[model samples]
Target: MSELSRWEDLFREGNLKELSLGAMKVTREHFGNSVFLRGLLEYSNYCSCNCFYCGIRRDNGRVERYRLDDDMIYAAVDSGFIRGLRTFVLQGGEDPEFGTDRMCRVVREIKRRTGDAAAVTLSCGILSRESYAALKDAGADRYLLRFETADTELHSYLRDGVSLERRLKALEDLRSLGFQTGSGFMVGLPGEDDELILRNIRLARKLELDMIGIGPFIPHPATPLRDAPQVPLEKTLLATALLRLFCPRAHIPATTAAGSLEPDGREKMLSCGANVLMPNISPVEVKPHYLLYPGKICLDEDGLHCIGCLGGRVAAVGRKLSFDRADGLICKRRDRVEAGT
Candidate 1:
């Protein structure tokens, strides 16, 4: 069968290998062998909401928690820079302590340190428009706020007090401010329907986001959804393939959550249409401590395993990580000579 036909067969038959190979081919076509890597620095474990699938819900007192200090963040960023990571993602939960002013200061310092050597992407959960603007002003180039699910009633069921309208608005808000916006969804949440997946992609395309991140629902033991079954790998790949067909050229990451659930999930996702990766650069001391979902993979493993040692994984499937500068941000940096950017 042809490439497009093969992808359709995999989805219809739910075949992992066929789907993965086709998706990988698509990924290679767009990204070549180059795997764009981002340093995922989990700045804080504290959060305000109670997502039924997260281990770090505010009520989870049993979960060990810690927040990275400004000095610590600087140190981590320095380490990542040396490792040739030009994309740094400051990811954290929604803690009141990390207010707009505080986060802007953090973003400013990161930008100063980056010095054209990196892009700062923020995944610090939901925030007010003022907070979002403050961070954007501080040289933060991207914002990754996963919507979890697109269905309104189901969205509210999974995430308290959050709605589809609010999340979609946040995405629009980020785009209007000239930030590379990212929206995400789970493959299978309770009460989720395949139509929602189509709708989610439709909305993502409508937003013209720079990135769209997604992961299968992985239940965490201290939460209400602990007993929930894992989303099958087939479903995840199918969604990924459709994303490739839909988005064509948008950046789609093969998330660690995929790797956490299935040993070879990254390779599978790569085959399906993933082009970006977020390597965990958090201090190993606290890396194992931060658990949004328990049994998250590559946390305790050395960073080499997550990126470098994965050479075998990529090569096994006819793809390789690229070590060149990346392209694609909603707002292109205007030439200083022309627009005085």
Candidate 2:
């Protein structure tokens, strides 16, 4: 019943790749050769809070702020749908333009336009429980809220006084509302140790999360941690594999941050244990400005290009892109619900 002993053994004794192979097998068992694609639409970059590690934080005067109107957002989703995408992840900074009513309208419109064929995911920052419920009523199927780190002090330091309790409460609220809730952590963060990373994995399992997104800590030149060390690729891969080993059915992404860190990072992630790919379908002109960290890949490409490129990458790793809208963690949970166990 010791948490560390359970999760830590997978990392020791030069067994990183071995653990990855086991995780990959588990991933295949649950997901087959299908990798789900979520079209990423970064509709706005004007954030209200200034997280120390983010490039688009409010205090960073260099960021070019922009918010796409309803027409432009619909246009982007329309383009992605034509290219075989069935899920749209509406991500953005905490822009006030996307209030509860406006966001619900967007979600309702996307569902209406796609005949409910497209799954809408909201990744806008923390909102009230009422707002979360309203979005769900408007047909949003998934929600992503990264916990960032498991350590409370580290979370406070990184987010500039924000409490981890509030974040966890928001996650709980989302799950209570039947969202396929996702929470993530960063490997090699400024104050993180192996123990902290293992706790993060434990936390994900404890939450019964539907999905988890693990990526390396990449520093942004414009942020407070500009001089912090970049997370080693080996460490990040180890963390991804470990998450898969523990949470066998969670939807894990080969994050664009990883790919930007190493050219073949995404492919390696697929082999390691990842089962999701979020291609940037955001407005191309605004894509370059939505920099969470430096050196983000595929900013130069459009939605169609990302679809074709990621499709090729998925195939290269001997897996195929999944066209199913409900192919992620939510479907896996249905069995548990039906059995009432």
Candidate 3:
């Protein structure tokens, strides 16, 4: 049988034990027992695009949108930094109010405050090449712009006519600008199949991404895909293991979406191959409003509390929670460039 057919059979039969073990072995070879932790700050819910599966899409009337000022953003970073988080992910929707200049200021100030102690990662969605270069110049070390899917038709449909080509272009821009680029896809989207999943994996490899985050698709009640069929979490876990085997050095996170699916879902992914965890450090009041899908965990918990919980989770699975900046291969390459090596 062909390699694709073999994987298809494994996925079809729901036999992931051997696959997961192999993935775990590869992860151990590369990352050892250290799982990097990134503090996720969802500072805004305002977005420009109206994606069908997103909870904070511009057309969604029910989400209470709010953007954090510099003071609030700084405070969140300070809190996480105190708790020993060296990597802070400033994530939000593509709000125009937080334009290039404002974002540059934010990145610069954060770097100033943290000195060389922290690395900042941005995930605010697609932007112009100039904007990306400006952010990189301002001290942003990593960028996550998930392409969502490899199938052009489903990608455009889910994103309301935004072509896969456009998304891929944005990723290329980030990479060319020397950002530690990260991208991912949801495991079970409407119209997604084994072929599409395989293609998604191939695309990640083709991009040579520094990070790969895969999560299961969960329906948001307020979005167009509210009534979409529920995808099994096992499929997502299988994909996670496969991603690990395929891209052993890429940083893969045990996404919150997995935890939302089951109480122990994130932990399960860790066993499979994931070596990173991003605990929500956004303010408690605004956490509920930043929901990309329903049943998101940790909306009520404070940053320190979430970190404490994740520490236990990591320990339970025999992995250490690393406080290092955990710069991936791409980020290291950027460092070498800046150092004139």
Lowest summed lDDT across 10 adjacent residues in model 1 is found at 329-338
Q: Tens-digit lDDT track for model 1 on 114-224?
A: 786688898877777887888888888889988777678888878876787887788778877778778878887766666677677666666666788988887888999
What tens digits encode model 3's per-residue C-alpha lDDT throughout 112-223? 8898589999998999999999999999999999998999999999999999999999999998888899999999999888778878988997898999989999999999
What CA RMSD would you report for each candidate?
Answer: 3.6, 1.9, 2.1
TM-score of each: 0.89, 0.95, 0.95
In model 2, which range of ten residues has the least summed lDDT? Answer: 326-335
Better candidate number, 1 or 2, judged by lDDT: 2
**At residue 259, what lDDT does model 2 achieve?**
94
Best by lDDT: 3
Query: What's the distance in Å from true for residue 63, model 3?
Result: 0.8
Separate clash counts for every candidate: 6, 0, 0
Displacement of residue 131 (Cα, Å) in model 1 is 1.7
lDDT of 2 by residue, 1-341 (tens): 56446546867554776877787888899898889988889999999988999999999999988999999999998988988889889999999988999999999999989999998889999999999999999999999999989899989889989989999999999988878898898888987888898899889988888889989889999999999998778888888888888888888998988899999899888888999999888878998899999998888888678777888999999999987775456545764786796
Q: How many angstroms is residue 17 displaced in model 3 relative to the true structure, after the best TM-score fit?
A: 0.4
